[model samples]
Target: MLEKVTGLSDLKEILHDKEDEEIVFTNGCFDILHVGHVRYLQEAKAKGDLLVVGINSDESVRQLKGKKRPIVPEMERAEMLAALEMIDYVIIFTELTAKNIISELKPDIYVKGGDYKVNELPEAEVVAEYEGRIELVKEVRGASTTNIVAEISKRY
Candidate 1:
């Protein structure tokens, strides 16, 4: 259950054994898992040997997505991602940005959805410092948590 969810210290230890493996990292709120999220993660995994997802904590999500957001709890969201075969590990981060985690992990490839530009990503600088490349995955059209929530609200 919690096996795939790890803290920074434990993740660091695990990463030590993956020296020969290419690590791909991506961070997001992931409030509601959907086809878009699935496709994005699958594509991210294709770029490296292991895909490490940095999940924004509940507090961070509230700050970023608004107080009423994150209809799903952080732990549950992490569990859902961990259950996916495309995901290798899940790390919950408390900060608004994954800059610190990116700096520490120094993944071989840092991935983001097509909605973001490589140069526009704050983590891009950190990845650059480690000589890691940034890749933008194609987004699934008409799929987003906000839209999903709005549609749900309209129904009930």
Candidate 2:
């Protein structure tokens, strides 16, 4: 499972041989794993032969979610995602958005939670440039790390 966690260059090398497969790509901070994440990933995986997840690096997560965010560290987060049965590959990225990763990977399909609009995504252009399909998985209502954190805080 840990072996599933890899760097971009190495992932590219590995993916190079998988040209015959329909690659599915998705990215997020994944600060704290939850049921919503599991279902989202499973849905993403069903879109293609392989599911590659780009995780936000610790610094990137901080930039996006504020300093006290990312309840889990980057490596731990990557490992957690890699451990998932539906996830074929997991890579940590320092970018705030998935545009660079999407540009480089150019996956057959790009998946995101339905919470985001396709037109609002920065990586949507890159996906379109490569003629890749964009999929939006319906999010599980009331199932999010932010909500979990708030509930924990309120109880504590």
Pick out the ten consecutive residues of candidate 2 with the lowest summed lDDT: 61-70
Q: Write the per-residue lDDT of candidate 1 for residues 1-156, one digit (tens) a residue.
A: 579999999999999999999999998999999999999999999999999999999999999999997889999999999999999999999999999999999999999999998888989889989899999999998899999999999999
Off by over 4 Å in 1: none
Give candidate 1's whole-model lDDT. Answer: 0.94
* Candidate 2's TM-score: 0.98
List the global CA lDDT of all models: 0.94, 0.94
Residue 99 accuracy (lDDT) in model 2:
95
Model 2 CA lDDT for position 7: 87
